[model samples]
Target: MEAHGPHADDDLVTMLTRTGERVPHPDFDRYAEDLDAATLRRMWHDMTVVRGFDNEATSLQRQGELGLWVQSLGQEAAQIGSGHALNGNDFVFPSYREHGVALTRGVDLPEILRIFRGLQHGAWDPEAHRFHLYTLVIGAHSLHATGYAMAMDRDGLVGTGDPARDGAVVCYFGDGATSQGDVNEAMVFAAVHDAPVVFFVQNNQFAISEPVTRQSRVPLAQRGAGFGIPAVRVDGNDVVACYAVTRWALERARSGGGPVLIEAFTYRMGAHTTSDDPTRYRTRADESYWAERDPIARLDAYLSSLGELGDDAREAVAAEVKELGRRTRETVRSWEVPAVASMFEHVYAEPHATVDAERAWFERYERSFAEQGVHA
Candidate 1:
C-alpha cells in the first residue's frame, strides 16, 4: 500500500522506505554516513528486539506479572533513533515509556520491569548508563535536565571546545507534556541560560485520550520558537530521520549552541498504559493507517535492499529475541519485592526529625504485625 490519508506529506524527511528504496537527501543522508552496513543492520536488529521486549512487557502486564506496562509499540524509531544520537557522557532524562532508549543505553531489561512491577522506585544507577530512571511525573524531568545542563556548564563539562569531553543533556517528554507549565518553564530556563540540552518531544498524537489537536493550535515545533530554541519536526517513525535530526540538535547543544527542540511526529500504537483503554477514544481506522507506516517494516525493507537482512539473519534475531522475552518473564517471576521498612531507608539516608518519626512509626507497625503472628 502506498501513502494514503488526508495529512500525509510527500516532503516528509523520509530516507529509508517501506519498499527497498533509500532516497537521497542532503541532510538526512549525511548524518547516516557512519551507518555502514553493519551499523544499519544493528539498528534494524535493535529495533526488532526492543519491540519484542516491549511486547513481552505488555503481555506480562496482561498476565498480572507487572503492575503496569507502558507500550513503546509504535514509537520505537523515535526512541532508538534519538537515543543512539547521544554521546557516552550525555545525560538522558526520560519519560516513562522509553524502553527502546533504555535498551540503547544498555539498561537491564529486568530493572525496567522492576519500575513497572512496583517493586522499586528505580532499580538502576543513572551514572552507570548516563540514563536517568523513568520520570512518570509528566514533563517534570525537563527541569531536571535543564538544571543538570546548567550545572555541566558551571563544572566546565560542556563548551570546552572538546567534543570528547563536552557533555550535553537530552530530555524526553510527550506532546501532552507541552500543555504543562513545568515543561514550558524548563524551556524558558534552557533558552535563557543557553543550557546544553535538547528537549525531545515524542508527539505520539494522543496525550492519553485527548488528541494533539485539542492541545495546541499550531504544530508543537513552533512552541520552541517563543523560547528562542531552534526547533525541527521529524517523522518519528523514520528512525533515520529521527537520528539525524536529533544528532544535529545534540551537536548544536554540545557545541554551546544552546537548547534546541525536536518534535518527533509519531503515534502511540498502544494504550496510554495498561490502565488505559485506547479503544474508547481512538478508532481502528487510525491504527490501520499507521500500521502501514510501521517503522520496523520500513527499515527491514531498506535492509533487504542491501541483502543485509536475509532469512537466516532474521531467524537468528527472532531466536535471540525469544530468549530475551523468556529471560524477562523469568526475571519478573523470580524477582524479590523490597521490604516495607526499606522505603524509609531511602527517605533521607540521614537522621531527620519528621523522617525519623515516620520511620519509628513504621517500625512500630511492623512489630505489631509480628506480635499478631502475621509472618510471611
Candidate 2:
C-alpha cells in the first residue's frame, strides 16, 4: 500500500504467479477476468515471437550486421501485455527496446532493423501506425508524448464518452529514465493539464550498468503519486497482470482522467545493449532469479494449464518462430546502405539553409575523394 517503500514489489498488482497460478487482486483482477484461453494463448505467441526476433537481432549485432542492438529478453510480457490493451487510435511513444510493442502495432519486423543497420533515419511512417519512431535520447519523448496528449485534449479527443472517438497516448520508457528531468517535467505538465497519457515504465532493474537501487530508494511508481498522478506497480513478468493494469490506465486517461504511471517489476536478462556487458556489474545469481520468472515461459505455463498450449501447438509456434528468425536474418543481410547524401534528408520537416550548406560541403568532399580514386 505504501508506494514510497524500499521494497517496491510488495505492493505489485499481479494476476498470475510465477508458477502460473491465477491469483486475485481485489481491484485489477476485474480488468483481466474477461481474458479467455484463446486470448491468453495469443499473448503467449506474441511474447514468443518477440523473443525470437530479439534473439536474432542480438545475434545479428554480434555478427557485425548491426551497429547496435537492444534485447527485450526478459521484458516481453510487459510490452506485449500493454500493447494488446491499446485501441487503434491510441498512439505509442516508445524508447528504443520495444520490439513487442512494434509487433503489436503491425509494424513490419524487418523495418525496425533499418535504423540499427544504418540504412535509414526512420523506417516506418508514424502516422500510418500511430507508433512513433524509437527515441534513443533518454527520456526526451515523454515531453513529446505529453505535448501530443495536450493537443489531443484541445482537439476534443478525450472524455467524449465515445469509445470509438476518444483516444489516449502511452509513452514507454524505463526505470532509469525516471531519474531524467524530462520525464518528471512531463508528469508535472500532464497532471496540471490532465493530459491523456499513460507513462509506462519498464523497471528492468538497471540503467546500463547502474542498478535501479542506485536511481531510487523508493518505488519509481511513487514519482507519479508525488506529481499528483495515480501510479501502480505490477508484476511485469506476468502478462495478464500487465495487460490488465494497462487497460485500467488507458481507460482512465481516455475518459478524461489525468496521466497514470505504471512501474513494471521486470528484469533485463541480457546486456543493456549489444555494446554493453551486464556481467561486469550484475551477478549470475541476479540473472538466475529473474530467469525463473521468464515472461514467455510464465504465460506458456498458464496457457498449458488451460489446455491451450499443447505439444502440437508448441511445435507449430516453434516453426513460426524459426521462420521469423530466418526472414529477419535474410532481410538484414540483404540490405544495402543508403546513399551518404540521404543523411541530409529528414534533418528537419523542411529544408534549412544550414543543412543545405552542409550537404554541399559533403558533396564537394565526396568529389575530392572521387578525384583521388578513393571512397568517401
Candidate 3:
C-alpha cells in the first residue's frame, strides 16, 4: 500500500513506505551515525521503563492512587522515537497521552502522576524543558504550536541559515483529534505562514470507539495537501523509521522548508484512557493483530539481527525498568499533595482585586473549619 497520501506519486510513496523485510530507511543510517551503542541501549531501556511506568500508573488509578491515568502502553515507540528526535531547544506541544514524550523531555514522572492524581495542574515549567504543558482540550495544542512557530518566525529565530538556532515545534495529537476544527485551523495557519512546525498525528486506527475509516474517506496525510503542506506516512511501530522521519521533518522545518504532516501508522494497544475498555468496542483479534507488530518487539528483532540484543541484555533492561517503576511509584506516593492555597498561586503573577478577595475568603473559610475541629 502507498505509505503516504493519495496526492503523492509512486516515487514519494515508495520513499515513505516500509523499506525491506526489516523496513530500515537510509535516513535511519544517517541519523544512527550520531547515535552510539550506548544511546541505542539507553533508548531500549527508556522504552522499557516508560512502559513499566505506564502500567504502574494504570494500576494505581485502578487502585485509587490516581483519579485517572492515560495509558500509552502500545504507543511507546511513536512517543519515544519522536521525543528523542527533538533537541533541547525544540518545543513539544503534547496531547494527554504523551507520557513517554514527557519523560524523554526530563519532566519528572512523579510530576505527571501528580496531575492525574488531581493534586496539581501542571508540575513543570515549559521554559525549563521546552516541553509545553499537556493539552487535554483535544487539538487545541495544534494552534498553540502554530502560534509558537509564528513567534519564532517573527523573532527571526527560524531559517537563519543555521540549524542550531532555528528550532522546530512538534504538535502531537491522535487520529481522533484531526477531526477537531482547531486542528484544521492550525494546518491552515501553518501552511499559509510557512511555520517551522511538524503536525504529528499518531493514527492508531481508532479514535476512541470510532474507526479511522469513519473519520475520513482518504488517509489523514492526504488532508495536509489540501492545506498546501507536505505530508508523509511511516510505519510508526518501526522506531527507526519514526525517528528518521521526524528528524528529517524537523530539520526541513528548521531550514525554512515549512511544515510537514507525519501520519504515524501505529496502533493503540490499550484503551484510550484508564476509564475506557477496549473490549466494549473492539475484539481480541484486533488487539492481537497490533500486538504481533509490537514496536518494542520489532526493534528487538532488528537489534538481535545485528547481534546487539540478547537474552541477558533484555533481562538487564527489564530489571532496570522494574527498579525505575518502583522508584517512580514511591516518589509519586511520597509527593506532598500541594496545599489548597497553592491554587491561588500561579493564577496570575499580579493579583486582581476580585481574585484576592475570593482567595482571602476561601482561606479564612478553610481555617474556620480547622479551628472548629470539623471531622467528617
Best by lDDT: 2
The Cα local distance difference test for each model comes to 0.86, 0.90, 0.80
lDDT (Cα, tens digit) per residue for candidate 3, span 307-352: 8778899888788778877887787788776677778877877868
Error (Å) of candidate 1 at residue 215 is 0.4
Could you give candidate 1's per-residue lDDT for residues 1-376 as a string of tens digits?
1232312345456666655477767776778777777877888888999899999999999999999888889899899888889889799999998888998999987679998889787988899999998999998899999999999988898878898899899999999999999999999999999999999999888899998877886778878889999888788888888888888888888888999999888889889999999999988998998898898888888888778889998999999999999999999999887787777766675778998898899899889979999995
lDDT by residue (1-376, candidate 2, tens digit) is 1235433677889889998988888998789877999888889888998888999998999999999998999999999999999998799999999999999999988789999987885799988999999999999999999999999999999999999899999999998899999999999999999999999999998889988878888888887778999999999999999999999999999999979999998989988999898889988987887889899888777787878889988899899999999999999998887788988988899879999999999999889988999963
TM-score between candidate 1 and the true structure: 0.95
Residue 339 lDDT, candidate 1, scale 0-100: 83
Clash count, candidate 3: 0
Rank ordering of all candidates by lDDT, starting from the highest: 2, 1, 3
* Candidate 2 segments whose C-alpha is farther than 4 A from its true place: 1-7, 372-376
lDDT of 2: 0.90
Error of 2 at 163 (Å): 1.0
Model 3: lDDT to the true structure: 0.80
lDDT of 3 at 304: 65
